[model samples]
Target: MLTALSIRDVVLIEALDLDFNDGLGVLTGETGAGKSILLDALGLALGSRADSGLVRHGTDRARVTASFAPLKAGHAALDLLDEAGIEVEPGEPLVIRREVKRDGGSRGFIADQPASAALLRDVGATLVEIHGQHDERGLLNPRGHRALLDAFGQIDLSSVAQSHGEWRAAETALAEARERLLNDVSEREWLDHSIAEIAALAPEAGEEEALAAARSDMQKGARLVDEMDGVDKLLAGSDGALAQLRAATRRLDRLAAEHPLFAEALAAFDRALIEAGEGEDSLSKAAEALRFDPAELDRIETRLFDLRALARKHRVEADGLAALLEDLTARRAAIDAGEQSLADLESRVARSQSAYRNAAEALHAARVKAAAALDKAVASELAPLKLDAAQFRTAVEPLDQSQWGPHGADRVEFLIATNPGAPFAGLMKIASGGELSRFLLALKVSLAEVGGAGTIIFDEIDRGVGGAVASAIGERLSRLSDSRQLLVVTHSPQVAARGTQHYMIAKTSDGTVARTGVRSLDAGERQEEIARMLSGADITDEARAQAARLMEVV
Candidate 1:
């Protein structure tokens, strides 16, 4: 509900402040008493388009601020404010301010936090629905029809939307899988041949390194064997030094028994013989190690060539062939099982589709039932608002497959026929300005508890209607105010008398500057204002009596 409005230098409103209350409040005054100016100021605060002309003469800028306090939680405007990063504490009023400069520049704020006019407009839509003869907000938009209908019927659509999303996800997965299968068909033969070739090779880890070392040894075998044979001949052959050393040692041992110098010579010869035997044993071991068959050397060289060739052909190192073989084998297996996997995916898609179809059908059925109830409910309101001849309808039509959405596979529209025997058409197309306002009111009354802004303002809803018709309009507005705050700008004395709170808009001049002001009417003041509306410029005793009677009825 709008809590307060402050205007500064906006047209004739030099400085004005007005506080609002819950329930129905009506603003009444003589023609050109700045009632429209008050609305313009409110509109500017609600983020309507700005114009430098709106600024008062000689003023640099014009500013308007509006405060709203939603009595209940979970109002849609709160969500919008949250999304915009505007803070509104519990029990705190949300303040929106707009300033238009004489230079045609403008600024806006929500909760004193700087905001864009576009965002302010979005948030304002949830706070107020300004219905008039030329209304474009609220029910005038067809986009919100489905959601409004669902709210009216108390239908919860989260499950249906969730199921639809899941179905789409399943269908997307199946399509991608099928596309992969079709694209890979030409590669099936190539994959099979590669798998077979790699399997036949049976490459082992570290085989390449072992084979290379053995080949290096085989290549050096002939040179190593020749060197060992030369050492063996020098150390133990028939002309070798070992035999000469044995003869010398025997002579030295005999002389040593007679002379001490001989003993030294015999010991030296013994050491020489031990050294020669050690050298011969070392050479024999080397000769055995160097030995290699020609066929074995040939086999090592051929295996090395085979490993290198295969490595090059596969664009990998010889050591990596084993890993490559495993990958090819896995890919081959996948192709072999592709058909069964695709079949399983198809079954899953079918199940998801069935679930989605069931949910959509159920939603469609509920909408049809809800639409009929809504039509009847709105029809009941039409006759009281002086539209007994008008026919109200809720048209539900099936949507094409491509148009089927998360909500449902149906489109809902509000239709009307203002005269008997007239074909029903869109509300905007068939009803005149006055008829449209009444029709909107009837529809609003029917769905008063469904989806509506916290504050609703009707501009001259009683236009061109009088007597009982005016009272009926007032009664409906009052009923609507029971759930939400309502404001009506009217000249009808009966409607003005119905306001829980009455405000009189009047313009005054201080010889140099003219300004607009609004004041809340007290009990006695309200009677005088109503009487003025009843009898025009002259408020007679009879008009006052009638005003008292109207207040008594209220």
Candidate 2:
């Protein structure tokens, strides 16, 4: 509920403060007495569009602040604040402040923290619902009709939302499966060929490294084998190094008896011949060990080239080719099994669709039932508001399958027929300005127990009616306020008389400057104001007496 409103330098309203209370509150005044100014100031504070022209003449800026009492924990306004990333302390009052400068720049604040204008607007919408001929939300827009009906019936759509999500998810999975099958079927031949080529090569993880090592050793051994031929040539014949060493030993032995030096030389020559013979034997064994088939090196080279080429073709290292082969083989297997996989996905999609259809059917039936009940209730309110010839309807029309969604497969709208046998049409199109106001009132009265904002403001709701009709409208407003706060800006004395609280808006001029002011009216003051409304520019004794009677009747 709105608790207080403060305005500064807004048009003719400079430094005006007013406190508000629950139940019916009325703002009554003569035309051009600045009653509209109060509503405009309230709209500004509620995050309506800002205009520099609204700033008071000779003022640089204008500001409006609206303070509301703490709301229920899960109220729509609180949820809106939460979604905007704004936090209010528990038990804290919600204070929304908006300031517009003369240059058209504006700022909004919630609880003293700077906030975006959009956030302020969104939160404000949930707190107060202003219903007038020009109002575009709530009962005016057909797009929001479903939500209003659901709120009215206390209908929970979470199950439908969950089922819709599951259905969409299943459809997505089916689409992906179909796409995969299409793509894999197209690649089936390439997959089989690649797998076959890889399998034929049969490359092992360490085969490339082992083959390289073997090739290196063989190439070195080939060089050694060529050099060993020279070794064999030097050590094989009688004139070779070992044979010459044997001849030297014989000559040294023949001269050994001639001197001791010759005997030592003979022993040295004998040991040299023995050592040369042992070296030749070792060289022969080494040459035999180096003997290997030349084709073995060629074969290793061929295998390594094949492995490296295939790895390059597949964009992998030689060692990774084996793993790539496994992956391709698995893909080929899946392609061969694509038909069954698609069937399985199709089955799941069908099941999900069935579930959604069942849930939507139940929701559709419930909406139809709720719409009938609402029509009946609104019908009960129309006669009292001087709309006895009119008919109210809550149209529950079925939508096509493509339009089915979380809210179900129906379009809900409030329609009306202004007279007997007249065709029912949308509220905005068929009803006149005055008729629209009454229709909204009757609709609101019917839905009063179920939904709407904490505070509802009606501007000129009693515009085209008087006498008994005005009294009936006032009675409904009074009854409507029993559940929530209601404020009516009116010229109807009967409606004004129904208010538990009353404020009179008046205009005054100080020679050169004119200003608007608002003050709470006491019982006697209310009587004078209502009398003025009754008599128009003059308060007669009979008018005052009638005002007293009007007040007592409500």
Candidate 3:
């Protein structure tokens, strides 16, 4: 409930502070006395758009602050504050402040924490619903119509909504699975051909390096064989000098006994002959080793080329051919199983669709039953508010199957017929401003216990009708205030007299400027204000007496 409102330098409201209580509080003033200015100040504090024009001519800024006490502990606004890490004093009023400077810069705050105007609007939504001639009635929105129907009907539809959501999720999952399987099936033949082609190559690790080494050895052997044969002919042929050397060494050895120096020469010549023989033997063994076939080199090169060509054709390195083959084989296997898996997914989708249809049908039926009850309740509230000729209705129409949503397969609209001969039309189209106000009043009184807002402000709701109709509107407002705080701006004496608290908004002019001020009126003062509303500027004796009677009756 709104506890207090403070305004500073906002238009004609130079400085004003007002306290409110939990009951019907009416603000009464003459034409152009700044009643609208006060509402605009409250709207600014509630996060409406700010304007530099709102600042008084001599002031640099304008500020409006609204304080509220949550009727319960776990309000949505409190939850938002908790999420933002803003602390609120227990049992203390929550203060929301908005400031607009002359330069068009604006700032908003909640519990002293700097905030955005949008945040204040969101929190203010949970605290108050201000209905006026030009206000956007959130309840009238088509998007909110279903929830409003459910709230008015007092039906718990959350479980049905949850079940419908689950069905939708299951159906979505099944459709995705089937789509994947269909794509896999389309690629099955290609996958199988790739797998077979890669498997035939069967390339092994390190085979390329080993084949290259063998080829190198064979190519070198062909050249070395010819060199070894030339060396052998020189060392071991019939005209070889090693034989002559042997004969010379033998003749030297015979004279060694005559001379000791000659013996040394013979010993050296014999060592030379032995070394030459060992050289011949080593050349023979090397020639045998160098005699490799050239065909062996050709065969090794051919095999190496085959393996490398296969690697290139498959677009992989020689070592990667093995892993490539494994991947293709697995893809082929998955493709082979795609059809069966797709069939299974199709069955699952069918079951999910059935479940969704069943849940939606059940919810639709409940809404039909609930809509009827709501129509009757709203119709019952109309007669006393001078809407005897008006007819209230909850129009529930079935939506197309493809258009079905989480709420249900239905579209709900609040319709009305304002006169006896008129065809029923949407409430927004059929009702005039005063009729809309009365209809809203009836709707609110009907759903008071269901959709809870801490404060409800009605700006001139008692505008068009008078006499008994005014009295009925007052009684309902008073009744609504029993459970929820209500603030009303009224011109009707009956409505003003119904207020447990009355505030008079009056214009006062200083020598230089005119300003607006509000004062909470005592019982005697309230009678005078009511008398003023009843008789205008005149305030006749009979009007005062009637005002007293109306206050007493309310």
Q: State which candidate has the highest lDDT.
A: 2
State every prediction's TM-score relative to the real structure. Answer: 0.87, 0.91, 0.79
RMSD, every candidate, angstroms: 3.5, 2.8, 5.1
Predicted candidate 3 versus true structure: per-residue lDDT over 1-554, tens digit per residue: 89999999999888899999998888898878889999899989888998899998899999999998744678889888887777787777799999999999999999899878888888888898888766665555566688888776676666557767777777787777667667767887877776777677676778788888888887888788877767666655556677677777889888999999999999898888778778877776877777776677778888788878878987888777778888777666766786677677677767766777787777778888988888888888899999999998888898887877777778898888998878888766844788888888898887777775778989888888898898889999998888889999988888998999999999999788998989999999999989998888999999899999998887
- Model 2 worst lDDT window (10 residues): 426-435
How many collisions between residues are there in candidate 2? 0
Cα lDDT computed for each candidate against the true fold: 0.87, 0.89, 0.83
Query: What pairs collide in candidate 1?
Result: none
Clashing residue pairs in candidate 2 (N, C-alpha, C atoms within 3 angstroms):
none
Residue 492 lDDT (model 1): 91
> Between prediction 2 and prediction 3, which has the larger lDDT?
2
Cα deviation at 365, candidate 1, in Å, is 1.6
Better of 1 and 2 by lDDT: 2
Residue 509 local lDDT, model 1? 88
Scored by Cα lDDT, where does model 2 land?
A: 0.89
